[model samples]
Target: MKYFCLRLLLQSVSWNAPLRTACSSQTLELKRMKLPSTFQESSKRFVHQVPATEFVAFTRSFHGTTMGALALTSEERFHEPFELVMPGVTFVQYGSIEEAKRTIRKGKTAAVFVEPVQGEGGIYTATKDFLQALRTFCDDAGALLVFDEV
Candidate 1:
């Protein structure tokens, strides 16, 4: 393969990994599912009694095609098919700090998912101010800040 990161392309296989170990997609799935869910579950189960079931995602940002991820996406095409199964997700204009503030609530927001550089809708990069504001919002709301680097 060309490289591990480009494995999805199935071009070539590079040798001499940082560590000699086997890998699988399950590893990535477990890692991905763990981080975001942990904050929500821990807060509701152990710390805060409020259930942060809602999420804040950027409009026009494409997270994925999966049910949960598709719900977070702003595109209507992907969500139209699985509208009933998709969870509720709040969307704010990308890079709009003020809009995000209005959408994210302390007891309601479970997590804020964003792609620093959006690729699907367009190649739009998040502003430093927007990211910094998100950090503060997550901390104050006791939510997790998840960056989808895909």
Candidate 2:
């Protein structure tokens, strides 16, 4: 009876075949999208009531399928159909610290999302220096740094 119940429970949880990152990575994306307000309310980073709504994403990077993730994505082929209303996002050139420096802003940008190894987007990898720069940028800008490793 226990084995039958366990099997039934497992079957009840329908898992997606494509983009299984939905289980974990998407949660990080959601947090990235919504944590600004929390930070504002708590007065942890900044005292302003208005939360920073802007986000930074890498060009040609794939985060996940959540609404914010869809917005962060650069490929039209992946998210054009859904067209879900999402938060503001700026797409910086992938692996280019120059573009990221230009895009991230203090008191406005909320977070920066990146994948160390962009497998779906042609398996490109980020350099150690590039990531280090992003860390500095986020720290100076008071924005969250989210690394999506699926």
Could you say which candidate leads in lDDT? Answer: 1
RMSD of 1: 10.1
Each model's TM-score? 0.65, 0.63
Q: What lDDT does each candidate get?
A: 0.58, 0.57
Q: Compared with the true structure, what per-residue lDDT tens digits does model 1 show for residues 61-85?
A: 7766556666667888875665576
Clashing pairs in 1: 1-12, 1-13, 2-12
- Looking at candidate 2, the ten consecutive residues that score lowest on lDDT are 1-10
Model 1, C-alpha of 91: deviation from truth (Å): 0.9
Task: Give lDDT tens digits, candidate 2, residues 55-145.
Answer: 7878788766655456667787755653446546677899898889989999888777776667674767676677668877877787766
